[model samples]
Target: MPRYDYRCRACGDTFEVSRPMSEASESASCPKGHADTVKLLSTVAVTSRGGAVPPSPAGGGGGCCGGGCGC
Candidate 1:
């Protein structure tokens, strides 16, 4: 299941839902009785190996250290 962010166009309320991807389009509504809610594109945080990997520097090679350091 993936968490999705939504915004209520009728009530200006924002909320999150955790469900299967197939349910996203059908489960869009505001808890405040607003039916004009829409899904909002949002960013999600991801961690691997119990650590967060930082983004690579711009204009650098495809390596983690930005270049070959032989570390």
Candidate 2:
């Protein structure tokens, strides 16, 4: 199950619900029992154990992959 954020227009209330991806577009009833609600776009933050990603080489690189063409 995935959590979704919803905002009620009738009562101006916000709530969260967990449901299947297939039901992601389904309208959810607010806690106040308002059916006129809309799902909100959410943001996700990603982190890696390897730390930040390294910057790519300037002006691109060799025609080969990974700039390791021995140019």
For residues 1-71, what per-residue lDDT tens digits would candidate 1 score against the true structure? 78898899877889988989778677676888778877888887766886776766664675656666654
**TM-score: model 2 vs. ground truth:** 0.74
lDDT of the candidates, in the order given: 0.78, 0.89
C-alpha lDDT of candidate 2 relative to the true structure: 0.89
lDDT of 2 at 31: 95
Task: Quote the lDDT for 51 in model 1.
Answer: 75
Q: What's the residue-level lDDT of 11 in candidate 2?
A: 94
**Candidate 1 Cα errors over 4 Å, as ranges:** 47-71
Tell me each candidate's TM-score.
0.57, 0.74
Number of backbone collisions per candidate: 0, 0
Worst 10 residues of 2 by lDDT: 58-67
Report per-prediction Cα RMSD to one decimal. 6.4, 4.7
lDDT of 2 by residue, 1-71 (tens): 89999999999999999999998988899998889999999998888999888888854655776566755
